[model samples]
Target: MSPAAAPRVSVRLPGHRQMALGLARQRLAIGILVFIAFTGLLGFRLIELSLFDGPVQRARPAVANPNIRAEIVDRNGVTLASSFEAYALAARPRDIMGNKEALIAALIRILPERPPEAIRSAIYHDGKFRYITRRILPEQAEAIRRLGEPGLTLEREAERLYPHVGLAAHLVGYTGIDGRGEGGIERAFEQRLTDPAQLEKPLALALDVRVQQALESELKAQMDLQQASGAAGVVMDVHSGEVLALASLPAFDSNRPGGLVGMPSHMNRATLGVYELGSTFKAFTIAMAMDTGVLPRMDERFPTTPIAVGRQRISDSHPKGYPLTVPETLIYSSNVATAKMAERMGRQRQEAFLRQLGMMDRAPGELLETGRPLTPAPNNWGLASVLTIGFGHGIAVTPLHLATAYSALVNGGIYRPATFLKVPEGAERPGRRVFQESTSHALNGMLRLAVLDGTGRQADADGYRVGGKTGTAEKVLEHGRGYDKRRNITTFAGAFPMDNPRYVVIAMVDDPTVGSRMAGSVAGPVFKKVVNRIAPVLGVAPDTSGASEPDIRMFEGLYKPRDPKRDPNAMRRAAAGLPPLEGGVR
Candidate 1:
């Protein structure tokens, strides 16, 4: 049959139908390509968001409030405390999807410090969210994120960082995980530190890091050598009341403050601990007497014979058998002589002098931890109180208070408030005159003599001409009910370059057991070391004019030789002109 017309069966064909079918096939192919492209783009976008997005994008709604604190720097612009962005691990207990026991066990492996029971309890708690750990490292955050638990989350937060670790820890305190300042200057200046408008500017402290290091090193060495429980030291600009360096040993690292909570190591001994600073107060007593004209002249003599007040007897630790001149009283650190002077000054005048020296109140400073001085009540200011306080036994004051007083003694009698903030050059601080310039000069000369020929002889730092008084006081026990004879607080408070005083340095050792346990043996060496190291850094030139010689000779023949073979009673016998007793004096 013919191909095109077999049995006359021909298919009908229309041009419009053929065109419509071709158009429909094309439209369907184009629709499928568009859908594939849209799906590919969506997948890429999701990958980018998961891998490249910042914590801000990935953080869950349970994040804590962000706290940004201002930076804290030393006088030289070295950063001490600063803030950085960190990731914290948080958990939404209700949202946990993994096996509870297994998840907690795994968490314990990562955070071994957390007990297994703690993890379990936290996960089982009814709270919506809670922090597992804060300030997690990036690797830790990554490990936590890969745990595949819906409850676990990484939250962006700000964390305070102390780059210097334990350096000046007592002064530049740490903050809580929530970024609130907890102590030290951190807490003292919290408002200014957190102010939004002031955040950009760093808080500059008067602390010279070099000086601080020197002070800490010496104090820590003495603490270790003497097996002391604690120690404190300070270096202050006498003229301006700027605290160049303040150190308290057994200090905790500001970075890990939680470890030190409730620990004795956390105490700011320089400011918070009030102590019965022994003979160091003798300088102040003499200065006060001289200033008030109770002692007419340095040549005026006070009986060195033991004085009886009730059952207590006031005697010099290392007494000169003869009477002591006003300057000789300080040079020999004669408690009996000083008590007689206080008796002459009387209670009212003595209290008024102490008040003038700022010893009757808490130390004026930015630190909220400034200790309230333990002064006697008005009614308790009897003759016995006066005698004991004259020799620094009844009254207690912080090392900071002593430092302020010493500054006034050397800085031409100006009593300025101690400050942690740097004082700009030419800045004028409001201060009150506590001593006459003549009185200050005379006291300085006598202090220089004490270091030159007396108990503070060990504290002389070559040409620095270190001048200070040694104090060894028995610690009070049972909340001031009695005294612990074995335990003592040894301190040496002084200033450098006797010719012209620039810095007031203090070193205190709490309960030293090694060697003699005298201020000269424990704290005086620390003062010398600190001054030796920081004097050069402070640009203080050594003056060897030997101007303290005359002052030193004024106390000639006043100090009796200590009999080492009979050390326990040497001081007493020397005072009494009796033969040495067993155990001699220290």
Candidate 2:
């Protein structure tokens, strides 16, 4: 209230006004700072989105991964393929700072899949970018990200996933680190698989998962039981040429090719390894002869006595002195009769016939792998070659070739290429004629007779009307000359529901030891098991006679034996016209 105080107050601004001005200054300073920050951020964003567009990335541009779309399904619309999200850790080796040893130690400690040495080599590679590892675990990738290393980058990628694991390993095959097909259906149709449009659509295979599993299950069990070296099997629709089931032992895991022992495991023996597939080839020979009009009736007689050519002798595994009929020859697998039958067929007719059966060449199917047929040329194929090859000697062929051939000979004489993909009706390629329908029918009867009365009884499945031949081929020696009799390839190539002949199943074991048992004892049981399971799936009615049933014929004899001169000169002349006799029958 004093005069001096009033004068001072008049000179000063109001407290409230002063306070308001101070508040404004504070807000203006904050606003300016905020504007500068926002401008800088907007400029940075503009440079990133515009200048670095496709190349610069927050998460590494997905690394050009196929960005796998959904998988393909079968005709039944079952999921055969799908994709899973994965992470790939990579680094610019030049930029990786900290001691190389330390980083590798850290990586090795965390990711043990790759050896420390391997990781070091990869990390130090001379490149702009190199993958440290792919399909990284989320937690692990997150841990790496938290390390905040500028040199290392974690990329988001989509990888092809086979949900069933090994369920369809051979059927679907698998992809490599890069999205490329490696084998089986995957490799066979790599181009189609990589096609984006095809990826959207489902890939249907002819395989029945159930049948495949069953076949594998039985085969694996038998293999272990017999302690066999390797096993292979196939179930094909005779009518459609669709492979319902095909499997090979020492089968590698598609998820990881290196998971197997070696390249040997990758080889598809069913389609690749050529062998002198013993008696099973007799079916084709007889069929060829019959079709050529050179084969006599099943009742026609052949020389049961041993036939000699040079120093080599053609003798039956189960020989008889009396002349054997055509059916008897097949039933007993008489080497003499079959060889004689080949002589009757002669070279021109035999070679022509075999070529007709797709025997003188290779057959490439839908597999990335292919099979090579080992047939002596007509010039090299002398009398001996004809006889030897006629009985499945002198030359070798893959089990698939024989299977396809047998399928043709029995399935109304139409040899359809076996397929893994589900083929639409009428889409199958028609094969060259190998035999007459009549020959096929007769073959069916003989095969039935074989199961009932011959070496192939083990192939019979009650109601399935199974017909086939059993072959025990000795393995070729490593050194060259003779066959290693101790190591044998036991095979049974047969068809079931013989009357209808819907599917053909082939079972083969490589170097199967004659343990305490023989081929018939070891491989035969496996054959029985496979047929029992697959028959019903094929809609083949059970033979009223269980699998143990045999066809016993009480029939009249076909020919009267000629009581002629036992001429040694005639036999010596026969011996002159035989194979090279160099390679032993395996």
Candidate 3:
């Protein structure tokens, strides 16, 4: 082993060769280290880019059509409102390549409705973007696109379409250009309508389009005939408080929201206008009296003579010239008798009854246009107030309030809050009991009798057994300083098929002319027309059979027919309290 070690160091080499070999070894070692370092740096840079680099540049989103909003339908699946795709004309001020004046003139030619000044302003504005016109027709959009203006653009948008024009305008409402609800049911259900999860489903309302048409037709005809300032009507299901038809005259087209500016055409008179609904209150008064046992029997007599209270005299519009039974008071619409009955009930009980019937508060429903009922202050609710309110003078309420109260009166004494939505089967809330079932039955009989033989004769629909009350209240003028002798608000509060009432129909005319001022002459006829047409549509079969035996037996001998042959002088003498006939008043 020692000998072999000594032999290895004997060789000599040139300086350049040795230096080259040394350099090569050193370079090889350095190259291997550099490779490892470069590999690690590249791996670190890749990880950094993957985890911590700013957001990577992404391609612009593709332009797509706007999504359509949901549709609105009536109870029978009739489409009321819907949406469709449309193009909006917009401009990019920076990208506009055409002459500004030329673009403005071209836009005016295609969309002539736009003012020339507005189009010019939009085209020359400093802003980056502006919409020249929204909801343009497809043809108009195509024409503008073909103009080849770099600045002009057609962006897809959703537009609301009202199929029925003015039908249910107040109920279905209208949406703005930005695809948001502006009023009525559309506004009430805005969240649900625009919800992404429910856009495909249509909203169903409780209104029956057929019934609505009938009601509007009759109300419009009567309004035209009477030359009224305005008219309103409603048809409601009593048990569920579902509003079948609600109409306000002077209706505006929902599709044309711009035309409604500075106009009262969109006022929902049925639920938003409060008026003194005259003798209709008599029915409520009599019902309250019966329910509370103040008037024990239908034959109980109340003197019809004018009652002087606090310098104000309450008298019947048509005097009976003698004491009238509880039933006869309503039949004759005697304000004096109704006042007497209401006075006996007193203000506390009277207010309680009204409050129970939802007359003292805003109408409960989905609509935001409900009016708060006007009532006297607690301190002002004196004896005179009670007497006046008995005939619907001191207290003012919307036609909707009257309709709901009438529903409670005949719908087995239940007072349910009115609803505009379709109530599923067995989904109705249990209503509060405002009167005894027996009281409702008795009132039904009296209402029928009034239509058959009393002042409500004009409201009688042949074979349909329509029953209701007529109201004619003088409008308060000069802000309640006094009443206007020339103006009156006439109303008819009615229910059909008197045996078992299913619907409550209310028709009212504001400030009808003198010739048609009476409710019996104006609103009564409207009610009859509406009921006659909607009865079969609502599935209410006509019962040609006369009043039931119990009804006849109870009402027999209660109403004394006017003797057409009686001496006119004798009748006059009796009215003056100077009696000549044996049956005359003392």
Candidate 4:
């Protein structure tokens, strides 16, 4: 072999020190490279979190960490329910370097809405934290808890829990999956509900559970019996103007609202249903005439002669041709007489009366949705228009409008707006005056007569001395070009304890079919049924005078000379030629 190629092998080398030097150099280089790569990665992560985070992080501990559920309470300091800190499953796709598949399977058990495919993609995406399930039930949460730590994270967050699921469903609206109020008092008082500093206080509502239940029960029975489309009932304290019971059927269970039908159950029809209010406005008109010193006696007659408006006919449900007295006008609900009164009062006086009674405006309350009454301008008002309005026509008002007006008429002519929340002591908002004291007192007696002997007999309770008006206006249908009078709205607005009025009850049914009993038949009876249930709960004992009421008549046939020769058939023929019909009259 050549000398250059000869082996450099040394015998008995000391500790192989020269070989160790080469190996150490290689190891040092690897260590430097690893440290530099780690620093770059950490810097990138800091930038990503700081710059790209939105409400998620502020909501993160809320969305991730399970330590911040808020508490919910009722007015009486009852813990209807509360939430506790619980882990919500979320994932940072990039951070999940392990099995993306197995992690998703674990996640599926917690949130079914997100299928395995969705989870896999989420775990593989570049998001910081994608929510898997928030506000999970305790059982579901426990199941997720059993999943050992891997790609799964149990970050602390507040989970909403409703203790009494159906008790206050309407009052305490539920929160979104992320713990935010969506409706009812929860949404209304959201600032208060989610207020970090003021959660110690419970949300106080003016609802009495007992009264609400009673009202609901009666309304439900009627809804089913009548097989009606829908029903709403309200009981308001005439004196305090506090809403005792506001029940709208078809209510949804707020605790579980996933599959709920929107718009129907959630709608507060009592405050939202604006209708012509039929003859319910008659009481207000009569009161206005009485207060204005126009109708001096119940026996004073209005020329029961049918009058014709521009395109509408003024008549009564029950036709009378004689000069009917004021009491008879109300007892028989003479649309012609009412129209005459409206004409005498004129549009200016009518508007003034309505404004004074708070009917020309929206119903009073803290509800986000309050209905406004529709009163066309007076200049546009004509004789027929004024007459129709006096008898409660051409002008559409809400049930609340009727309620407020009735309350004023009974509460010594003081108009008070209705409220859903508790009003403080000495906080009685003495509303503007709509009726005079004597006028109200006299009307109360006349109203009692109507209940005892007139069209309002159905609303009379055995002892409550309930006096109210029945209104049934053909439902104004908007066809292709004009309104079709195919449907109708039937309503009854009444007050109890004729001697001392305390509460005003308003019951209304929309588009009630022409059954064996019509609006006066169906709606009036339904209203009486509601009164039956609510009167006791409201502590308004029966007067034991249901069988008897004060003696008062609408007219004495003394206001105007009665013409015996006035052929009723001629007036009918004249009214039949009642201005060419412009809108649907069916």
Q: Local error of candidate 2 at 198, Å?
A: 2.1
Among all windows of 10 consecutive residues in model 1, the one with the lowest summed lDDT is: 563-572
For model 1, the local distance difference test gives 0.82
TM-score of 3: 0.82
Question: What would the TM-score be for candidate 4 when compared with the true structure?
Answer: 0.77
* Local accuracy of candidate 4 as per-residue lDDT tens digits, 487-583: 6666777888776788888877666544633456767787787778777766777645222333232222322212221212222234455432233
Question: Which segments of candidate 3 are over 4 A away from where they belong?
Answer: 1-68, 92-95, 112-121, 124-129, 259-262, 545-550, 561-586
- Model 4 stretches astray by more than 4 angstroms: 1-44, 47-87, 91-130, 159-174, 258-262, 377-379, 425-427, 479-483, 514-517, 545-586
Index of the highest-TM-score prediction: 3
lDDT of 3 by residue, 386-425 (tens): 9999888988898888888999999889999888988987
- Candidate rank order under TM-score: 3, 1, 2, 4
lDDT of 2 by residue, 1-586 (tens): 8876765435655697889999999999999999999999999998765654322334322322444643655545666667778898887777777777777777787777877877888678786567778887898888787666677878888877776666656657777666656677776776566566666676778777778878888878877777787777888878777887777876766666645435667777777778887888888888888887886566678877877887688787666778888877776788888888889889999877777766767754678677778777657888888898888777788777777777887789997777777878677566766678887877776776666667766665655567788777777788956788677788888887765677788888777544633456556667788989876765666745233222222222432212111111222233455232232211
Using all chains and alpha carbons, the TM-scores for the candidates as numbered come to: 0.81, 0.78, 0.82, 0.77
